[model samples]
Target: MFIRAESKALNEAIAPALCAVSAKNTVAVLECLYLNAEDGKLTVIGYDNSKGMKTSCDADIIESGCILVKGMKFAGIIKMMPQGEITIATDERNNVSISSGKTKFEIAGMSGDIFPALPELVSEKGITLSQAFLKKMISQTIFSYAQTDIKPVYMGILFEFKDSELRVCSCDGYRISFCKAPFSSGESLTERFIVPGKTLTELQKLLKDDDTPVNIELTRRHIVFSFNGLFFFSRLMEGEFLDYENSFQKVFKTYITVDISELIDSIERAGLIIDDKMKTAIKFIIYGDVLQIKTATETGKIDEEITAEVEGEDLTIGFNHRYIIEALKGAQISGDDKIVMSLNTPFSGMVITPVDHEDYKYMILPVRM
Candidate 1:
């Protein structure tokens, strides 16, 4: 296989695909990037059996063929090369040569036929959304995704589409995040799917904060996202996600409205003295119009107070420092200066929402003090 491509365009196309290349895989082919030169285009693919990405760039195709090259090494070579046309060629023995301007390099490649086949890209069910909207939804809720594999379903974010509205929900054992937006498909369509958190993390990096549209196709066991000459597909987790709609408490005994930045700053100050070795819970003492933040550990203790609009009964709650801080940060993403915190008791979870609208909701369970 032989082809000539511009260094910048080739590097940009190869960057996102590398997210699927396994760093430590038993199969060598899974660690390499599959390169197919055909129809005057250079197609690059990276797959580790579960999730993968494919992207193409225009190239001067000399002899159409396919080969697999080490993902990192090949990308590095292309990225460091001069800003000009790069010549890539492979011989019968799979010895690859890369040359541009006066610089040249050679690496070993394997036959692309040995790589695992990707899932079919065709799907009857599909939806289109703006990249910016999708990116914001994921950013607000992905933090609650389970990092462990104890429950396979919790490791993904649930996507629910119905009645011209789209909702995304995610939950770790200790907290839950929910976000929704209006969606128009121009036809009657209802679909629900869970995309692995790892896939969304990588897809978020490739998505731009603009109005560019992204087309999403969904099947029973597979999902595909197409945009800007890129096709990303992943296997869906088959299980029932948590019923997040009913997880949040509807009634609260205590409610407070406080500045988001001030609350985050107070929590960060309390976290400074706590570490992994010290499992101390941050205590919140709310009464009248003052919210006191306190934490005591082997290292030290912090007693900070911030003013807020408090109503209902005075409540005292204890929570993990990291969990509350993360929940607060996630709430801040709504671009709101003030947030409302609703609480029921010392044991019940605390709910955080924006002052104006309910576009996002985050809940954090308190810890035993």
Candidate 2:
């Protein structure tokens, strides 16, 4: 393919497409990226058997053709090249010649005709949601996703769309984390599916903090995301997601409202005494108008108190301070906002929600003292 494009723009297209490149394969056609230069546009495509990505860059196409080059090698060459225009051409022998202002290089490439083809998405309705919202939802919940390979279903984040509200939930058995974003109006996009945590993570990296709409299309076996001239495709897992909504149906006997930063600071200090080996717990001595965080070890101990607005009965509870800290960070709480904590007993999971909103919910199971 004879395509002359600016090095900066070329790299931008290559980088995103590499998200789907098979890093596991040391050899084979899967190691290369498909480059098609035609109709005044240069499109780069990469696909593993499961996921794929395609990105387009504006280029000066002198001759319309297609070729495949080692994905990482080609990306590395472009990455180090100067910022000026770069010309790439593939001859009949499948040798690729790439050069910019002063430097030039030639490399072996594969014929694009033999590359694996991507699946054709069935004609279905597409849903549009903001990039900023999707990014926030994933960040707030993905941390709690299951890491083990035993239960493959738990390794994914659930995308639940029901009654117009989208809730993303992740759990590692010990805790459940979730966030919600409203879909203002759409052409009846309602369904539930699990997207692998790793896939969500890669997609999150590409999402900017803007309000740019991300178009989503899904079928029984595959899901596609398109935005800003970039296309992402991922295979859907075959299983039903956990019933996350049922976890929030419990009755709460105690509710405490405290400053978000103050509780976070106290939890941070309490976590200092505990490490992975030590396995310490932060005991919460809840009583009239005050919440105390206490952590003790053979080496040392810590105790911190902060004023809280408590209602219902007073009780002492214990929890892993790390969960509270992570949840607080994910919730993105501010000074003006208060944290609402709900509890039934020391054995039940403590629910944490930010003031005046159901946008996010964090749950932490108590650690027995």
Candidate 3:
């Protein structure tokens, strides 16, 4: 392939695309990125048989050709090159040459025709959402995604749509997060699809936070996200996501309203003493208006009391301190406001929300550290 492109554009194109390249693959071609030069444009493609990415940029193409270059080697070389026009060409012997300014580098490549084809998406349902809204939904819930190999279905986030609202839910059996966004116009439909956390995370990194709209198209087995001159595809996790909404049917035994920052700080400070093997067991003891948060380990213990407007009888609940801390941080807490935590039991879901806004709710189940 013979192509001439600016260094910055080439680097931008490769940075996000290379993320899907397999670091350890049985198939040698999966470790390489396909570079195609055609019709005044250069396209870089990378995939590991499951997730894939494609990005294109305008370039001066002297000859139309295709080559597959090692992802790591190509990325490293391009990153170190000067910020100017770069010339890349592949010879008949399969040697790829890269030149910019006065420096030149050569590397071997495989024929691009041998690279596996990226999955072709068949869109049965499609929606458009603002980039900022999509980013928020991903950030608020993605951290709680399942990672265990036993249930491959749980290792992803659930996407649900109804009328003009979209919701993203994620959980790892310990805690669950749900975030919703408004869709201005769309057919009234309710469909649940599970998407791996890694895919949403990659989108979060690439999607801009501006007001641009992003198009999301989905079929039975795959999903495609096109935004900001980037195309991302991910294999959907098959099987049913556990029924999350049913957990909210019961009432909480105790409800406490405290500052979000205050509770987060207390969890962080108290969790330090709870060793990993012991499950970071931090206890919340509520008596009248005083709420005490404490944790103990073999070597040390931390205890702190925060005044809260508590309701119902006194209760003490044990929970994973790290989970509570992270959950508190994820909630969309408002300025100088008290956040409410409605607790039913350590085994049940605890609903959290800012006192000022009822539109958003965060639920996290207590871990029996």
Q: Candidate 1: TM-score?
A: 0.97
lDDT ranking from best to worst?
Answer: 1, 2, 3
lDDT, candidate 1, 1-369, per-residue tens: 999999988998899889899876788988999999999999999998889999989999999999999999899889999899999999999999999989989999998889898887668788899999999999988788999989989999999987788999899989999988888797777888999999999899889999998999987789999998899999998898999889998999999999988999999999898886766899999999999999988889899999999989998889988887777777787888889999999989999998886888988899998
Candidate 2 lDDT, 1-369, residue by residue in tens:
788999989988999999888765955678889999999999999988788899999999999999999999999999988889999999999999999887998999999999888888784656878998888888989788889967788888898887888989998887899888776454666778888887888898999889998988987678899998899988877676778878763798899999888888888877777786867888998999999888888767898889999998898998877788888777663223687889988888999888777788888888898
Give the best candidate by TM-score: 1
For all candidates in order, the CA lDDT equals 0.90, 0.86, 0.83
What TM-score does each of the candidates earn?
Answer: 0.97, 0.89, 0.94
Pairs of residues at least 3 apart in sequence or in different chains that clash in candidate 1: none
By TM-score, how accurate is candidate 3?
0.94
Q: Write one digit per residue (lDDT tens) for candidate 3, span 1-369.
A: 788999999998998898788776788898898999999999999988788999988899999899999998899999999889999999998899999989999999988889888787889988778898888778888788887867778789998886667877887877777766666545666777888888888889888878898888888899888888888889998887878777553587888989788787788888677787868678888889988988878969898999999997687788877777766767743233578888876667678776876435667766564
List, in order, the clash count of every candidate structure: 0, 0, 0
> Which number leads on lDDT?
1
Model 3 ranges off by over 4 Å: 24-26, 333-336
Query: Whole-model lDDT, candidate 1?
Result: 0.90
In candidate 1, clashing pairs total 0
> For model 2, what is the C-alpha lDDT against the true structure?
0.86
Better of 2 and 3 by TM-score: 3
